[model samples]
Target chain A: MLHVFGHLNPDTDAITSAVVYAGLLTRQGVEARAFRLGEPNFETAYVLRELGVELPPLLPELPAGAAVALVDHNESAQSVENLAELRVLRVVDHHKLGDLTTASPPYLRFEPVGCTGTLLLKLHREAGLSIEQQDAALMLSAILSDTLHFRSPTTTGEDRDAVDFLAPVAGIKNVEAYALAMFAAKSDLGDTPAETLLRMDYKAFPFGDPAAPQLWGIGVIETTNPGYVFRRQGELLAAMDHVKAEDGLSGVLLSVVDILNETNHTLVLGATEAKVLREAFGVETQAQLANLGHLISRKKQIVPTLERYFAPDA
Target chain B: MLHVFGHLNPDTDAITSAVVYAGLLTRQGVEARAFRLGEPNFETAYVLRELGVELPPLLPELPAGAAVALVDHNESAQSVENLAELRVLRVVDHHKLGDLTTASPPYLRFEPVGCTGTLLLKLHREAGLSIEQQDAALMLSAILSDTLHFRSPTTTGEDRDAVDFLAPVAGIKNVEAYALAMFAAKSDLGDTPAETLLRMDYKAFPFGDPAAPQLWGIGVIETTNPGYVFRRQGELLAAMDHVKAEDGLSGVLLSVVDILNETNHTLVLGATEAKVLREAFGVETQAQLANLGHLISRKKQIVPTLERYFAPDA
Candidate 1:
């Protein structure tokens, strides 16, 4: 049997991508099962419930002796535990490659797209297969979530075509309105627990000297209005402190981004070479927070900034 | 228009693969042209002459602003001069990737096959297209040459299938006989000019500190009978010395391989670190030549040995 999943911290695209790709592999006479590496965030759960699709089983790690196919990501740091032990049959990702090597070449279909759903949609068409109505909507939702309703800089023409092809079949009358509604569903995080908020879309990165104890935990919270998260800044910082202690990380930075505004306000904890950070971003820290104006992406903008700051001098 | 070519020092596979893959791309509505990076070696010229196929034009370098697609090889060192310029449309290769990156992702169809022709055959079948007779023969010749008539360690089951599928279409009554004929055409190099022999299947690599000058010119001469080339050993060594002087290289080695016997004899020119070579191969040098018994592949065996010897201390 073949097991398929995305990178850790299962988001809307990661969950829907695994499900759709497994369907494609299954139609080709492979007994493939879609699973998630971790529990889905509220937005993903809400979308699945709306589409009336049962959530795949939550799997923390890939099972031993099973052939695994990864989707959405290829970074081992963000992949399941014991990833080096299993047989990797294939990989379908949209992100840049990380530290991944196989004894033999695994079939790779990596593209620089806004979402994995866009890639799978093309794959199905190329294989002469069709995605049905309910699944098509889920796939569309993933594209919207990843590309921020086609407003992201990563959105390409293929992504627009994927949205156009699926919207009618998905019974969506207005794509703009539908995307807005989806964004609204995840907006009210005011009453949520601080830990759940921090863990929603968390990623960890290691930097500086290889021997040094330094790791950065970054969490991104997408909202229509950035002020919602800013209101609870004190509580979120306390939660970030607890998260830093639990993970034994050197620092923690949270990107509270307003997708509608295309801006992110960064709140950080822990001391890590302020001189490097100030020089890299041309911003000074104010109360452990840096107001980064007009930041749309973590992968393209925020993460690269942090990585450059943490990179040791050559 | 897409211009497709192979690596430098055009081999039989390199020349024929460009021709067949250009046919595949042309069928898919792309105006493609096949060309060779350098002059064809004896075996490639012989096969083309038998098939009544015109040789691709010798293009020593790619033109600026031309959209190019590469086949058979992908190493920048072996690729066209000024490869960083121009638009790369696609890459169809069967070797380990080198330091190659594109401004954007090109249409990559890389596989770990014995030959690029084998991969193009699979692509045609997947796209529901057929290979015509003229192109089919070209593809078959490439497979035969790269796999050493299916005796090289790189030969796989897919390569066998390709040869089987193309044998009848190429109008060959006996596969073994056809392959032996091709091998025999390249065996009689006794009367050829020493410089031409050295340029037949030559490759160069840089090693050690980039600040200091160091280069290795490795040549492989495949023959059915090793003694035919061994008889001209003195002349070959003298030619190699001249090549070293002309190129101002640190070292040069030639692998005279007997494909029928599956063994290769190595001969070196110029002074390099003898202690490094001795520890790498664990064998003493005899007359500046080493009998690398039963090693026929430069990529898999000989080049790796030289690289290990030249590798700086970890």
Candidate 2:
């Protein structure tokens, strides 16, 4: 069986891309099963229902030691140690390289794009698969989320090309209208802080050194609403800080987006490394706050910027 | 079975509204089957598939043999002569009143919007039935098409309200993006003249007194590409003129739309009245060929303009 595994704390792109890609694979006579790293959020549920696609069952902790093919997020030895006992066939992602080992070195595809969905789209197009309208719509949604609805600068020609290809297939005359509507629906923040916090996927990363306290990055994506971003900022930062303190983290990074404007108000807590934020964004840090204007998506903006800051000086 | 029928030459609004309204009726213990007057074009197909919806089979020529519920387009005694044998229980449309009669006076819902989808949205929302994401997506598509993606001045607060209510349910963030994509997809002119002509729903309206030559109105809707308006003008006019000559028409009215700009280029072929076009649009006879600019929509703009021109005293 072709086992397709997606990243931890999966987004719409991570889940829908895997699902549609799996559908394409199945159509090609491949026995494929899709697995998600975490439970889906409200937005993902709405999209799946709209397309009449069933959400793949979430596999708790990666099948307790089965073969895995990583998608979207990079695989690490630490993350896959439990699953390492089983065979890993391939890895498809858009993230920077992480230390990963497989018995048989699998086909590793890592392109610098906004999201892994874009890569899957490229694969689908390259393979000449006939994309259905529902799948097209989902892929478009993933691109929008990854590229911040086409407002992010990190969006490339490939991203726009994919959107142009899928727009007609989706039968939507104005994708921006649909994006705005979907984002507006997501702006209602009536849930508790914990619920909101849990609704998002969080990833833990090694900071400076593996033992130098863990660092966590949290991303929240929504359609453009500056007011909503401004309102959620304090609470989100506080929650992350609380989580970090409880878990004993060196630092926690929170990226909340105003998708319409392609802007992200980034919050960094626990670390006095203003240089880290500064080097990442070229903006001088203020007392404790860093406002990365027009930096919307974590996938497209924050991560790459962080990678540059962490890289050796040119 | 509950008969869910929409206007002839069904657009996105007409088809989607029918589906959503049917779903609502079905949930309320009504066995509703959606009926369309003609084949769904590429644009309509995209939406149906994206929402995982299947367009109901075409209703061959109004099913004069079966009970019907007239929708969108108005009906007349001549139009229903075959259906006169079957009872028409209700008339749900968003067009100006048309000559229609039933053995027992049926429920008549004729609002002044561009498409009947708006009424379905109201009914679904008012009924308090849960509108699924696909249903909501379809409903939103209908509204966008009917209202020219909200660019038409004919759009009302009610239309906006329905859009606001349905947008989130569909998980669409930006309605314009969806609309643009759908419209661009439909701009292909690779089809034969007959196919292109048949792609849009057409209706016959006997204009003027019986003594006068019969006048027929034919319209074609494209989500985008106003250039097609000019390109197809001669062919459409010729087709109408041919039909007119064959049927001894006094005049024929044709409208082509650039839905994005909310503009319609119209050609009126007949000697009976250039005055109606002039009176309605404040266009002089000499300026008819000067590109009439944005004419809004056939239902909201042209019809109202014609009414005003025909009845200056009224």
Q: Quick one: best TM-score, which candidate?
A: 1
Minimal lDDT window, size 10, model 2 chain A: A98-107
- Tens-place lDDT digits, model 2, residues A262-303: 556666664544567776677665534577887665655565
User: Mind sharing the TM-score for model 1?
Assistant: 0.69
Candidate 2 structure quality by residue, lDDT tens digits, B254-297: 66567766666666665444666665566654423323577755
Worst 10 residues of 2 chain B by lDDT: B97-106
Query: First chain of model 1: TM-score?
Result: 0.93
Give the lDDT of residue A91 in candidate 1. Answer: 77
lDDT of 2 at A35: 77
Q: Is the docking of candidate 1 incorrect, acceptable, medium or high quality?
A: incorrect
What DockQ does candidate 1 have relative to the true complex?
A: 0.14
Model 1 lDDT per residue over B189-277, tens place: 65788878887898887665433526878889998878877777788889998998898777777888889888878776534633444
